[model samples]
Target: MKSICGDLLLQRLGPEGLGAFGKPLNRGLYECIRGAILDGSLPRATRLPPQRDLAAELGLSRNTVMYAYEQLLAEGYLRARTGSGTFVADTAPESYLNATAAAITDAGPRAMPGLSPRGQQLLANASASPTQWGAFMPGVPDLRRFPHRRYAQISARLWRQPPPEWLSYGHGGGLPALREAVAAHLRVARSVRCDAEQVLITEGIHQAIDLVVRLLGSTGDQAWVEEPSYWGIRGVLQVSDIGMVPMPVDDEGLTLPEADAGRLSGRTEPAPRFIFVTPSHQYPLGAVMSLKRRRALLEFARQHGSWIVEDDYDSEFRFSGQPIPSLQGMEADAPVIYIGTFSKTLYPGLRMGYLVLPRELAGAFQTAHAELYRAGHLMTQATVAEFMQAGDYAAHIRRMRPLYARRRAVLAALIERYLGPGALNAQGSNAGLHLVLRLPDDADDVAITAAARAKGIMVRPLSRYYLGTPAQRGLLLGYACVPEEDIGPAFDVLLGCLGECGHAAHVARIG
Candidate 1:
């Protein structure tokens, strides 16, 4: 089997001979092996030739062959037989194909029994999902310009003189050092008031949302989400099979008048058990939930015995005045879950975030954490903890705050210049990386975004984020990925698309 597999691999390496570099073979051999695996030339249970044998055949190191096999195994496309030998996992994910075929039948989704009906719907929709940003998309930080070299330096420092205890599995909550650093950072950055014990680190704000949703309301219970809210969070709620009640948001944010909550209008016919809001800077529309509204929401949540989930995704860089206090900090009672993410503040690839649970709920969350994912990577957590405790994270944020603020200003100025007055109406430009680009009423942003993509420009349609009513029809263009010099040209091209689509009449007058 190993010899046959080698012959098959050799056939794929027809044109470019195997060349060695680093631990993995050079581009030629890597592609050859990858192509064979993709094309099914190496069948299931075909144990690969021992590393030494193949290395000799291809003039490569045994380590190179081993590295390729390790990558394949990590990606779930192959399996190792321990000391016995390595072989392809069962030739295909036969179960996946059968499940997919079943999903298309009236039998109603057989492949992914793990997903509920709502989860199935979200998955189906995600299949055709487009780019993450639309024109003038707000709330996304410019991650392309992040200091990768600085982070590499920090990682190197931790590796040089590693702490023996940092290698163990991180605590269910988080590394105590990171938690302490997060608490101090929050105090200075967002005015959040809490001790380290209050913080429960999770994967991202989405996971924090899920943990809170599952902990607070079970499947089929009413959960109030802001209208024109984060669709990702809504999808998470849907997958959990929870009943979602869309609450109307005003300039102040989600307004459930004490009278409004109890009386139950058409929108709130079914009472909500909890309210999910992005008060610091409301998503999409960019409206800052007012201080008055924040107090009102807390009062209402307390009165109705409902929990509040505050997703403070990008509240650190408020350009104008002081940042608003988190609902968790302002709560008079014990029912708010405050979630934060380092994805935007640092880099999304870090994959670390935390949920600040109310004191009453921390014990239950700790119990739930044990069953999910076992424990987080202790080394990364410890390194990050050092980054924060040593004042590097705060210094990084200070440097980024002005850099991002300038970008926001440049984008705003460009919007004012090229699009003209009223061509775009923006909210939450006072903070956050992206802003809303409200388009003309009749414009079909979905079609417009498709047109932009053909020109190598990308934007997100606002309709993608909402469910109840077709929220505003406009694009969400992220400014974070576009460079400072490219902003003008990008918008010009974007504006040209709008004009080509016949919406230029509404836009041309604005500039």
Candidate 2:
């Protein structure tokens, strides 16, 4: 032990760091030894030098070294065996030093691994907002208004005496009561044709879409997606290696001729295995699929053996006429999977969503869901079931609809008043939590959105949702999460940004 210390000590403790003799010698020696132990220069379990020898080497009084050694011993940094000299303690500090050294060694230069081609594609198409809740950040509900105390009371009651089965892994298809509640609610509210047995609960729309893409389509299979659709769906499909055919959408909803032409023109690509649509209220653009388009879509899918995924997200907040009936319920056995979530209705943290599947496909989906991801969260499901069964869910929606409508009205009124009708055209504002503000053809939506973000206003660029060249430039301004009082101020900030961009463009044209 002494030999080890002798070999390393001189180089480890430089002359400059060690104080001159008789000038705070004890404190200087203590600091140097402590630093050595902390830096791993004096390894764990190594015996420190004898006080007499250390004092002799440094030409210091023996008392100075003795005081330093005593301080270290008292601090538990060094331990003395009855017959053996002092050694470094095997304590948390020593272990931390060793761990830090190992980390540094492992960080040595090496080739960093790369993501798979599919993963790279997903990354390239990622569109998640950096800030989830704020002014003009789309798809986020105002969680502040949620009935937290009521939900907490229910949660506490359920946890006080949880069912033994619920304490373990839950059924692949969610809690039976929740399924029944969701089925009953949908049947009456959205006209979705489904029974409790046909509803499969998922984490959210993302997981539901993932399950469909994996189960129904093979890798590289074509899928018809509404151009300027939800970016998240695009990422999910891309990661699954499904080829996406971007179909244009007008006020009526997804156009059928473009998809039909692609199939009939002998494009050499495989027929689309699925068509994903937001029929009730299209995301970002907010167009409700017309009844005519709905019938045509169903017929086309039936003929081509393609499935349709109807993402009816946020359809409950419609301010106009009665809610549109789901496309799945429009035709018998329409090969449609209807998805709805509580993220918009309640809160996103609930992470509870359901799929209304065709009777024939229910069993397969349930089995696949179990095998792929063992579903849990039975307690939360049970609580939500109670919320729905007790009529709380319906009452809550009725209460929130008007509040969201008022906020939407304020946003629309401000947009028209500030930007004028010709400066920006608002599309699909009759329903949904967000509206698309179309800018001039030459405007740079991305640059304008970035400028808004710098001013603490959150807005998504419309062009980011498109796969091919964007036909129009715009911003997706969400009004649901923004408070009524803050809406005008937030829009004021956004207006300044738009003015700056417009000024820049005008100057560039003159140049």
Candidate 3:
């Protein structure tokens, strides 16, 4: 009998058993043993010492040890058999064993170094605790609310009056009608000037980034990324083994580290092949690049013979002020590769988005895309083309913009009233479906997130987005999916948790 067995027994028991304890001592013992079992520190089938022997080791009553074991027997996580010693349950989750085995295999001596670095990064970023948020987080539109009735009507009409080649694959660029509509949408909405031929439809912005990376940047080429930018882009760059030069971002979007006449000055190093930015609305920080900075960036690109990857992820949801002109529209030397997606504005499930690349890179990207998919699916592309042509897509964006803006406002006001300054200083509040809340320095974002989940509030910590230093701890609160009424109470819960975590006093200094 050992003192450790008492600890191990408690972990095998569930919360029900732990809560049933009438005394604090029982609760402590119950929790200790329960944790050990769940963590597998106490292997299955380890025989428990006799009750009297265990009681002697832990200085607990024999009755206490017996009672704990009996409670564990009632739970399916463990099992007992008469005349046989207690053993770990044979019925442990199959997936658990499979996962453990896979880990061992992956780490075998023969495994190559640097293998799965991307997978490792993904694991590090994945949330360890339960998320209070639902599946349709912010930045995700309600596709169910899409006007299916109207789209159905248009789709049916297109089917009836089919072009003889309607059944055939569209041009590698995209369906002409869809591209034309996108061109028109860009001109009127985003102030982008481009013909239908310039738009190359792909799956979404992620694929668009992939295409640009493949076509323009070679392996080991350097790419400048905005700090606290889109995580997917960071992941893509890592997987590609591309060198990353992190340019600091301010409230006015990405500020080149150096000043240059045409090239961004300060980089004594060779300029990156391209710099990736979310100019219309900066990603996590939500800073819109001013006209001056935009001009500087383009001039720098031109001087260095670099390209710019502009991810206009949420340009459609401009809440105040007119939409900004795209850098690609102002390109004098085909120096910008602008990527836009229907995923956020339309529906993510549509899997339709396009890249307006500089003419220099278009032919090569088209070749890469062709080899990757042979050709894009004809049916879905055709359906999407019809959706865009009938003006249904434009109408949907027009209808949802104000609705999301209202939600954004509600979320901002709630943050002000309930969380005060301590919880998060909401940035990027002027537009976009979500806002970033700067957390206190002492706060453990991971811990705060877990505590919030315990109270049924979902939020994302800003730390998850960064690859370098933990820029600032905060939550990425998405309002698009959350109902307007819940905004206030959600903050109330969040604020209450912040107070309990000893962070309330820091609230005043947060923003």
- Whole-model lDDT values for every prediction: 0.72, 0.82, 0.72
Which is the leading candidate under TM-score? 2
Per-residue lDDT, model 3, residue 502, is: 83
State the lDDT of candidate 2 residue by residue for 1-511, as single tens digits.
3456655655555665455334586887776677677677786798777878877666678998899889988987788998799998887354645664223234667998999877877777787877777899888888898888888888899999998998777665899999999999999999998899999999998999999899988987999999878888888888888899998988888987635543745356666798999888877687788888998898788777889999999888889898888898997778898998999999998898998898888899998888888889999999999989988889989988999899988988876666555434434747778877777768898999889999898999989999899987788888889999999999888888988887433322211
As for TM-score, the candidate ahead, 1 or 2, is 2
lDDT of 1 by residue, 1-511 (tens): 3477677766655546553222335444555655565556666676777778887776677777777777777765578777988777774454455642112124653575487666678886562344444434444566665666766788888888878766765555888888888888887766676778888888887778777777777778888888778888877887888877776766777767455646554553555677888888888667788777877777777667777788898888777877677767764444777789998888776889997776677777877875765666767887788778777777877888787777777877776676665655455447777756667767888889788888877777777766676646667766765667878888898888988898866763432
Which regions of candidate 2 deviate over 4 angstroms?
1-107, 258-268, 423-426, 503-511
How do all models score by TM-score?
0.76, 0.79, 0.72
For TM-score, candidate 1 versus 3, the one ahead is 1
Weakest 10 consecutive residues of candidate 3 by summed lDDT: 99-108
Candidate 3 lDDT by residue in tens digits, 393-492: 7888888888888888777666666557454444463777788777776678778777877777777667776667877877777777666677776777
User: What's the residue-level lDDT of 63 in candidate 3?
Assistant: 81
RMSD of each: 11.1, 9.8, 14.7
